[model samples]
Every structure is written in C-alpha cells, then in structure tokens.
Target: MDSMMMGAMSKNMESMPDMGMMDMSVMQACMDACAACEQACTVCSTQMMDCSPACMNCADMCNTMMRSMMRMQGMTPASMMAMLNACIAMCQVCMDECMRHADDSDVCRMCAQACQACMDACMAMKDMMMASA
Candidate 1:
C-alpha cells in the first residue's frame, strides 16, 4: 500500500474498539505478502501441474485473508487470529506441493517462495496481536 492509504488505514484502525492501536506496518506487510502470494499461486495454477489444485486453493485463501485484513470492522481478535492461522495453513500446503515440483518448474519454485513469505508475514501479524493482547 502507498503511504497515504497506509496512513488512512492506521487512522481507521486506531478508532476500532476491538482492535485498538494495531501495528499498521505489520498489517501492511501481511497484506502485501498475501497479495503477492495470491498472484504467484494464480500464475502457478495455470501451469496445470499436480500442484494446480493446491495453488488455486491457496490463492483463494490469500485473497480472503487480505480482504478480511482490509476490512477490520466487526472482526474480533479471535476471528482475526483464526484467519491468520487458516492462511498460514493453506500457504503451507501450497508451498509443500509446489516444492515437490520446484526442481522441474521455475514457476513452482517462485510460488513456493511467495508462499513462504506470506506465511512469515502472517506469523508476524499473529505474534504482534498476541503480544498486544
């Protein structure tokens, strides 16, 4: 996200009751990672390999995760955590599947890397939330 949008999100988040004073930078990183992972998975899915199904599933999960993060209203801490966990799990599955074909396909390798990055970003977001809690 751009600085203006991020500032707007930070201001918005500060007003929320359930998610008070969140680290917007962490949220931004997570969102960016999710977007990148989603794109990578989408591209990888078109390769029609064994990992296609997993890639498609992961892309959908990442898109949902990003959208949920973008809309913070009505989202409880528990729900946010659940979403993060689900995203991480889906990324793990996609990464594992892609890694199996990493040697044969550069696209799979790139997708797996994106999945790992997304997992790490989501983990960081989860850790930040837990610590604040």
Candidate 2:
C-alpha cells in the first residue's frame, strides 16, 4: 500500500469500534485483494466477454468492499458480516463467470484467480472475526 493509503487506514482505524475484533493484517490483505480483483474484473469485463455483466457487478462489489474496509468506523459487526457475505457472493459469481472464458482469454483467467484470492482472503477475515468474537 502507498503511504497515503496507509495513513488513511491508520486514521480510519482509530474510531472503529469493531476494529478491535478484526485482525489488522488479515483485513489489510483482504482489502488489497479486493481492490486488485475489482481492477482486474473491470479490465476483463471491458473485453466484451460473455460474462461481462457478472464481471461488472463483481467489480463494483469488490470496490465497495475495499472502501468499506478502509473506512472501518462506519461498520458494525453485523454490517461487516453482511459486507463479507455480499463480497463472497459477488466473488462466487465473478469466478464462475470468468472461469467460463478462462480457456479462451488470459485476462479472464487472471480475473478468476484474483476473485478466488479475494474470496479466500475475505473468508479468512470472517473466520478471524468469529474467532475473536
């Protein structure tokens, strides 16, 4: 992460009530993965693949998830859980969609890999939160 982003995350983490329950390292990894997945999905969607719609939706969701993590003060445990569930659902759709075109497009394959990584990271985050709770 850039210095600016690190500063922003530090500032945001200060007042986050639920932040205490979260593992900062895990959160950072998930947030990064989500951001990457969003960018990859966006670029891949523009290629006019058959999965364009799903990729577009996943891109938006991943971006939102990334932003939400950065601004942790606005979230509660319930909100965080909901966001995690939504992200997982979006990732599932994106991975499935992208996998359909993986054989024909390198971008699609990479996008699917990103989505899978993001999903795994998010799930790990949820597990961490649960363990802390």
Candidate 3:
C-alpha cells in the first residue's frame, strides 16, 4: 500500500520547493505506521473495553496525520512538526491506556505495539525534517 502511494507521491514531490531534501522513504514509513496504528486502534475500539475512547481518538489522529502528510501542498515545516507532535502525543496516550490491559488482552497488546510503532515513525519523520532543515 505504501509503495504504491509513495510512487504517486514522488511525482508530486518534484513540484514542491525544497522537497528534494525530504526523504520519501521516511515519509512512506510514517504513512505505513499511521495506517497500521489506525487499523489496530479501530479494532481495539470495537472491543468496547476500557481503552476504547483512547483507541478511537488515536485512530482519528493517525488518520488525520496520514492525510496531512499526503496533502502537503500548503503545509509548512513548522505545521508538519506540530502535527507530528500531536500524533505522537495521541499515540502515547493510547499506548498507555492499551498497555494497562495488555496482560489480559491480545488486541490491547497489539494496539499498544502499533501505537509505539506510530510514535517511533513520527519521531523519525520529525528528526529527518530537522536534519534536512
């Protein structure tokens, strides 16, 4: 999924000024992580368990973050960084909530893992952007 999307994104990247310094691979990884996190959170939310609210919130944030990255035409670096921070924060909250029941629930455990991965990917994207800047 990411590979195909990345291919399409690459063409658009050429039109964005200073985007040559951005690493498409990192963006791809971030998008993939967001997609995975969204799926995990959605499934976890359906359990109608204690962490459902946080999972649902994280899912929404992940989807927004992924879409923002996809539509970067008017996005500034500062705005992107802010969005990444927000996504990371949401992921952290969801992970903390999910981890509380990880010992008893496989879905919670998987959701926690997905949140961690999404956080890591967002951080990586931020780091790459800073380095490029």
Candidate 4:
C-alpha cells in the first residue's frame, strides 16, 4: 500500500515545484513509520494500561498524518511542517507514557519503540523540508 501510494505521489511531484527537491524515500519512510506506529499504538491501547489514552490519541494522530502525506495535493509546505510537528509531539507523549511501564510490559516496550521510530522519521521529514527550503 505504501509503495503504491509513494509511486503515485512521485508521479504527481512533477507539478509541485519544491517537491521535486524533496526525497521521496524519506517521505516513504515517514509514512511507513506512521503506519507502524498507529498499529503499535492500537495494540498497546488494548492492554488497559495507564498509557491507553495516550496510545489511542497517538494512533489517531499517526493515521491522520499518514493520510495527509498521501494527499499532498491538499498540503502546503507550511501545513506539512505543522502536521509533522504535531505527529512528533503526539509520538513523544505516547512514547513517554509507554516507557513508564516498559520494564513490566513487553507491549509497552514495543509501543514505545514504535513511537520513537515514528518521532525520528517525522524529524527526518522535517529536516529534509527545512534543508530543501
């Protein structure tokens, strides 16, 4: 799904001036990270732990972020940056919450790892955008 979406997005990039300078691989990585994080959060939320609320919220945010990336025609560089920041923030909160119970719960540990990966991917996207700007 991600590769297909990225291929379509890459085709559309010809009409987006600044987008031509963007790294499609980085964008693909970010989208993949968002998807993985969403899944991890959904699974973690089912654990009924103290991090459940954060996990749920992070999952929703990640899904929204991933969808926004897919619909680049509706996004500006500013909006993309804002969405990335929001996603990173949500991931941070979720990661922190999950980490609190990581010592006792494997699910929490995995969720925290996913959140960290999502945050890193988001930051990479942000950095790439900034560099291109």
Candidate 5:
C-alpha cells in the first residue's frame, strides 16, 4: 500500500487503545509479506505435488491474516496476537512442506522463501507489539 493509505489505515486503527503504539512500517511489511506468501502458495499449489494441500491451506491463512490486519477496527491485542501466531504456524508448515521439494522444483523453493519471509515479518510484528505492550 501507498504511504497515504497506510497513514489512513493507521489513523483508523488508532481508535483501538492497544493499537496506539503500533509501528505502521512493521505493519505494512507484515501485510506485504502476507500478500506475497499468499500468491506464492497459490501458485505452488498448482504444482500438484505432495505440498499442494499445505500450500493451499497456507494461502488461505495468509489471505485471512492480511485481510484481518487491513480491517483492524474490532481487533484487540489478544486477537491480533492469536492471528499472527496462527499465520506463523501455517507458514512454518507450508515452508517445511515446500522445502521438501525445493531441490527439484523452483516454484516450491520460491514458495518456501515467501513463507519464510512471511513468518519473519509476522514475528517482527509480534515482537513489536509485545515491546509496546
């Protein structure tokens, strides 16, 4: 998203007391990573490999996580933490599954990379939230 959109989103999220200290840059990075992971997983799922199921599931999870972050009006810190945990867990599974075929499949390798990036971004968001809490 553009800076203006992020600023607007941050303004909207400021209504939540627990989100007052949120770092917009970290949030934007997390959202961007989620979107990239979702797209990578969706493409990887079409490879019809052993990791297909995990890829599909991860794609859905990432999409949901990204959407939830974008619509933060009703989200509490606890709920946000839970969502990040779930996204991290899903990314881990997908990354592991994709890595299994990474030696032979470029798509799987790319998907694994995307999953790793998403996990890292989510972790950063979690750590930032904890520190601000």
Candidate 6:
C-alpha cells in the first residue's frame, strides 16, 4: 500500500466508531488482496487454460467486493457477511482450479496466491465482525 492510501485509511479508522462496524485495517487488507486477485485472475484468464471460467468468476467477484467496500454504507451486517462468504467461495474455486496447473503456469501460481490472501482477509473480517458483535 502507498503512504497516501495508508494515511487515508488511518484517518478513516480513527474517525469510525468501534461499534461492530468493519475495521479499516481488515477492509484495507481485503481490498488490497481483491485488487491483486483481480489482476492475477485477469492474467490467468488470458492464458486460455481450463481454469478460465473460475478465474473470470473470481475476477468479477473480487472487483465487486472491492467496490462494495468503497461504498460500504449500502451494506448491512447481513449483506457484508453474505458478500464475504460469496467472495471466499469464489476465491476457493479459483484457487482450486489454478492449482491444477500451478506447476506449469506462472499465472496460475500468482492467481492462487492472490486467492489465498483474499480468503484470509475475508476470514479475518468475518472474525472481527463477530467479535465486535
């Protein structure tokens, strides 16, 4: 993350009330992972592998998740949880498919890493939400 973005995120965290809402750190991590996953998935999709379907799906899902967080007021706790679950599932599917070709494809390996990072971020967000609740 860039220093400017880190500063903005820090400000946001400081401004937000600690009332079971999304944590900025967790959200930032998720956003970063989603962006990485999207990029990786796009590259992997261009490889024309059998994993293209999952890669495309994951790319779309990650983009949506990142955008949703950017406009997070539209989401309730229920919606947030549902979105996280969907994103995690999408990442899992993408990771599984990419792993099939990981030994032979650099794109697949990068995509799998991005997926794992995204999944971890989503899980952390869920855990934080539940703890705050």
Per lDDT, the best of the predicted structures is 5
Ranking of candidates on TM-score, top first: 1, 5, 4, 3, 2, 6
Tens digit of per-residue lDDT, candidate 5, span 1-133:
6789998898887777867599989999999999999999999999999999999999999999999999888688899999999999999999999999999999999999999999999999999999999
TM-score for predicted model 2 compared with the true structure:
0.90
User: Per-residue alpha-carbon lDDT of model 1 for 1-133, expressed as tens digits?
Assistant: 6789888878888778778558888999999999999999999999999999999999999999999998998689999999999999999999999999999999999999999999999999998998888
All candidates: TM-score: 0.97, 0.90, 0.95, 0.95, 0.97, 0.88
lDDT score of model 5? Answer: 0.95
| Residue 26 CA displacement from its true place in model 1, Å | 0.6
- Worst-scoring 10-residue span by lDDT in model 3: 13-22
lDDT of 1 at 56: 99
Checking candidate 6 for backbone clashes, the offending pairs are none
Q: Who is ahead in lDDT, 2 or 5?
A: 5
Candidate 4 TM-score, C-alpha based: 0.95
Q: Which ranges in model 5 have alpha carbons more than 4 Å from their true place?
A: none
Q: Tell me the lDDT of model 1 at 34.
A: 98
Off-target runs (Cα >4 Å) in candidate 3 are 18-20
Ranking by lDDT: 5, 1, 3, 4, 2, 6
Residue pairs with colliding backbones in model 5 are none
lDDT pick, better of 1 and 6:
1
Scored against the true structure, residue 126 in model 3 reaches a CA lDDT of: 95
Question: For residues 1-133, what per-residue lDDT tens digits would candidate 4 score against the true structure?
Answer: 5577678888897688855488989989998999999999999999999999999999999999999988888889999999999999999999999999999999999999999999999999999999998
TM-score of 6: 0.88
lDDT of 2 by residue, 1-133 (tens): 5657776777667666655656677888898899999999999999997888989999999999988887777788889989999999999998998898899999999999999999999999899988987
